[model samples]
Target: MNEFKKTNIENPVVVIGGGASGMIAAWRAASLGVPTLLIEKNKKLGIKILISGGGKCNITHDGNIEDLLKSFQKNEALFLKPSVYKFNNRSILKLLEERGVETYTRDDGKIFPKSNDASDVIAALEWYLRNAGVEIRTDCSVQEIIFENNCVTGVKLNNEIIYSSNVILATGGVSYPQTGTTGDGFRFIEKTGHTIVPLRPALAPIKLSNKFPYGWGGVAIRDAELICLVNNRKTHSERGDFLFTHEGISGPTVLELSKYAAMELANNKVELILDTQPDKDATMLDSEIQQLIGLHPNKQIGNIAGLFLPNRLVNHFLNSINIDPEKECRKLIKEERKQLVKLIKEMFIGTIDTIDITKGEVSAGGISLKEVDPKTMQSRLVKGLYFCGEVLDIAGRIGGYNLQAAYSTGFTAGESAAINYKSQSTTP
Candidate 1:
């Protein structure tokens, strides 16, 4: 049991994980004049941040904090209310701005660095931690957290024991194993009397059971509704733009609804129904198609359909319903026209095969929020222990909400822990 001497403080505040939340937590703790140490198993910090938003890093969402809270579920929003309000999107942006990183918000309210580089975000965070005198230990994996009598003492590594009264576990969930987030925090906390919500994949792509032979990999559908139907009844649905992958489909809408769809896929048969023309009903679309057919009687039916649907999907759409794409509009019968209308309104994509959690942008499920104090992000079951970021069972939809959660929760935990440490140190 060797004591680590990386910091001058008698008992430094130790933070595990070097991702978004961990970095912020260490910075905040050290900023309060508390010596802090950030430990990461990987060779570098913010590996996950570098790959987020396709390397652009959607830093946070812009708008009112209340509106931003609406992006998460009711319980999650309630749990995050205090922390998020304390360190909201504006708070995070101000920190980054002070660190020499300029950012801009998209029309849809997703904020990103002006450089359009994720490395800039990481660099700013690193600069903040360094200037604040936070000691970071990379390439060091925490084997276990040492606690006795329901109080956290510190963490145990391969050959060293770092002693600290306060330990913040900001380790992320089980997603993108390549980034080093392999559910280690879940394991560490579970052994310490924390209840973990079963982990699942969030913001992941869904693989389709129906394999379309055609290469529709790059084809995109705009303003379409993707509905998850179990036994022919609608269970969940979302509306936005989605792109066709070689094996399946992925986009904002699909990624947002993936959490629900993945849950429904366990027992029931799940099918994805795409409403390509959601704005118009079958009757309205049929009338428009009839008018087009009447005006161009000599034109091929497939060519006419191209005006309504993507040209690349026209032939497949016609063939799936047993309609001849080359048939002239004048020769089309009433039944065939109705079939075209039905297919146009609700195109059957296919049943869901599986949603791989490893490919998810964020993993759902973690340490139960009920076991943690929302006001301080301290564990209710264990003294001197704290949690933040994806380690909590709160996951928001795509578009900067999750990142904002990380920053807010981390700040709350760090501030609270540092204050608690100060009070304890001065106690008689």
Candidate 2:
């Protein structure tokens, strides 16, 4: 067990929220010989962590810093470079490993606990916090951030004010309100003179105007490309596996593009063009279909097409195009064959109605990235104040990128705050 030495500093470094970032920040600060306190509105710490990656807890993405940075937008990648480089996926894995939480990487590079239990990850972090001498308060909500002369003094809770030399607001975003991320940090930081980039649902399921074909729910298309079109012009596209739900579509592909879809839907009509056969062009698919017809002239068109796609989806597409599945391959006219090729190449899935924020994996557009220093995670306008995790405008694509951002930024914030506190306390 590691022992923490008593410090002369009177005020503790207070960390708000008890999720992934807050837990790491508190542990880092306390381990640095600085008194630290972590507060959570929920009854337990790491509530979201427990439910992340469908309860398996995606710890981080496996790759070099440069490759991982590509998962985010250009500006967001630039802002995250310093912290991510300092404390990266390897660093996080090493920390967890030392705490007896071994992790393994998936084929897609997502890292998760070897046991496939999110509870193990939380238990490890909680053990680290306890051993580092970090005090934790649960079921306590912060009403406001108390500041004087633009410097953080403490945080105001419902009952009392807890004084601290440095305060790290890792309160997360408005996503998953049931997990206690209700945009509390945004309100508090906005009150402290910060610009909040309008918050929106990111990495969420897309709700479509046209319902899925009856009994099509739970059907998934693998290795497909989903293209988002605005006014009949393709704006964005993503290639991955997408699953059909009763309302619309979900899965890695849809979730990754949901943010752009939501933005486009607000101002213009947004349609999803699904390319089931992305590997083959119209001419190639048409030629292949013609060859199939010649080989199996007596076979039904639906049976022949079933080789390429699910039987249910093939029937649905045929019905939409006014083609009869019972028609024999030999009976298919050239125009009918052309329609089938077009549908396979690009099937318009209709306009998206909405993207539900409450169901989003991560909330995008929090405190603007420009308002905080990327290196230290300190507020550019407020002294001794830090922002990390989803509370910042940084949200990465699916596959453990968001969790890496949280760990990296949390480490930087805690280390910087501890150094600052030590310097101030030692000064005459």
Candidate 3:
């Protein structure tokens, strides 16, 4: 255990929220020799962390800094560059490993605890906070941020005011309400004079308007590309595994493009074009179909289609193109073969019905980045005030990107706040 420096500061550096960012922020602040207090509205800390990556807890991604930065949008990447470079994936994993939490990275670059238990991740974070001499308050909701003349004084919990010159708001976004994230941080920041970007669902599943009328639920398509088109023009596209759900289409590819699909669906004709065999063009697929027909002249057309498509889809695909699946391959017409090739190349799934933010993996908007200093995560308008984690307008693609952002920003905010507090205490 490292020794904390003795200080005479009256008020401690208070960190609100007990999720990924808040825990790291509190631990970083307290470890820096400044007294720190962490507040959580939930019954316990790290509720969200416990449920991250379906309870396995994706700690971060495995890659160099530049490659990871490219995973996010240009502006968000630029803002995150400093903090991410400072703390980074290797840094967090090293911290976890030090706390006895062994981790491994997936082939896709997602890093998770070797124990495969999210509880261990939470235990490690909690242990860090405790050993760093940080006081933690759970089941306490901060009602307001107490500020005077555009400077944060502290936070108000219930009727009591907790005074602190430095406050870090790591309250997260409105996604996963059951996990305790419900946009509470937004209200707190807005009251203190900050512009909030309108919230939207990012990394959300796409609900189809037709609602899976084809009875294709539970069907999985591999190596497929989903293209989102509005007004017959391509808007966005993603390539990955796609799944048919009871109400809509989901899986990695759909979630990646759902944000754009939701935005385009608001005021246009939105359609999803699925390329099942992206590697094959119309001519190439048609040539393959001809070769199959010649090889098995006596085989049923449906049986021939099964050679290229899933058995479950053979009948439906052939029927949709006005082809008799029962007909022998030798009797198949050229036009019918072309139709099959066309559908195989570019198949229309359905229009998007809804993309609910509540069901999203992350909310895309929060306190506008313009008013927050990316370098330190401190509010430019409010001294002694800082924001980090999902509360800021930064969302990344699926994988371990979001968690890394939380940790990186949290570290920056905590270190900056602690150093600022120390500087203020020593000034004559």
Candidate 4:
């Protein structure tokens, strides 16, 4: 183990961000009796945390590491399993409860503060760090990183060079900029002689062209599948609710597929086919339609369409097939009515664009997972330098998975950094 010769600095570990991962890193390090310091550019830490999950703060998801890994995509999920196994959801829940943050898991396995208040979660983490003797510097910004011989030496903040033998960069991804994640960490990465993957938004809301009803703004399509099609071919699908923004669909389905959505739309155009009935086949829907047509032979087809969908959606589907609402069901052309039923079951909408990468919940592409050790969360390229949280290429689907990744990776990094520090201290 290489020892970074300690300066006269009081604290041994300096964590660069006080957000979810950084706070956990500092707390874990300090709990091990390592002198620790945490820095935050915001006037307060956990602003983003407090606002996450609409202020409920999905702290972590339930289930073991294997289950957690499936929540992520590509190599990001696979790389996180070992660290997650080392410090998974159970450990985090225990730590939070010990700090007075009571938590409960929802039916879907999302864990949150018992009060359902994100503030309580933040308070618990903050309290834990405080009790562990972790120093905090709020409203402070890091201007640059100081390094020598490929190892981090210290950081320059506000033009003042404060030195630390061991530094942990836990600054979060550039999403929710108002919360102070301004992609400042990327600048630090560029200065540190590390390669940054082309950063794009992950876990963010995608913008759509077709205007949706504001009444459906809060309507969630649980069990509803969102299938993305490029050139009329299905590219990806995720079954979850898509929350309607004044602009487009967001929430689980949109965020989960944002990476794919961004890629498929890169060539410019794509389609979002919302299968409200992914399970029921076209024949099943057709059977239901035939039965309804039989019962309403003299009634307007549009009036009975509501049995399967919203009233407005019914009319929209009928209109698409040039089926007149005033026309009786018996007068409807068989093929046209069948097409309306098909459109109802498989609603297609052209997508306008994806959310900005800077607005992603956590960035997807970072210093690439291949360059880092999953067991240690340490960069394979650097000797003693380690990484954690969103700064790495690892990102997960929403519902507390990403934050769990952050906490788990941060814990592993903290443990590894501390143990390595000890080995270095005892060496010669």
Q: How well does each candidate superpose onto the true structure, as a TM-score?
A: 0.94, 0.94, 0.93, 0.91
Expressed as tens digits, the lDDT of each residue in 76-195 for candidate 4 is 777887888888999889988887889888998999898889998888889989999988999988877777877777877764667765777787777777888777777876755578
Greater-lDDT candidate between 2 and 4 = 2
Regions more than 4 Å wrong, model 4: 1-11, 191-193, 213-222, 243-246
lDDT of 3 by residue, 150-212 (tens): 999878777567889899999999888888898888888776779998888899877777865
List, in order, the clash count of every candidate structure.
0, 0, 0, 1
Cα lDDT, model 3, residue 295: 94
lDDT of 2 by residue, 178-260 (tens): 99999999888767789999888899988888877658888888988999999999999999997888766787889988888
> In candidate 4, how many clashes are counted?
1
Error of 2 at 368 (Å): 0.8
Off by over 4 Å in 1: 1-10, 294-298
Pick the winner on TM-score between candidates 3 and 4. Answer: 3
TM-score of 4: 0.91
Give one digit per residue, the lDDT tens place, for model 1 in 229-276: 999999888999978887678888889878998888889899888888
- The lDDT of model 2 is 0.89
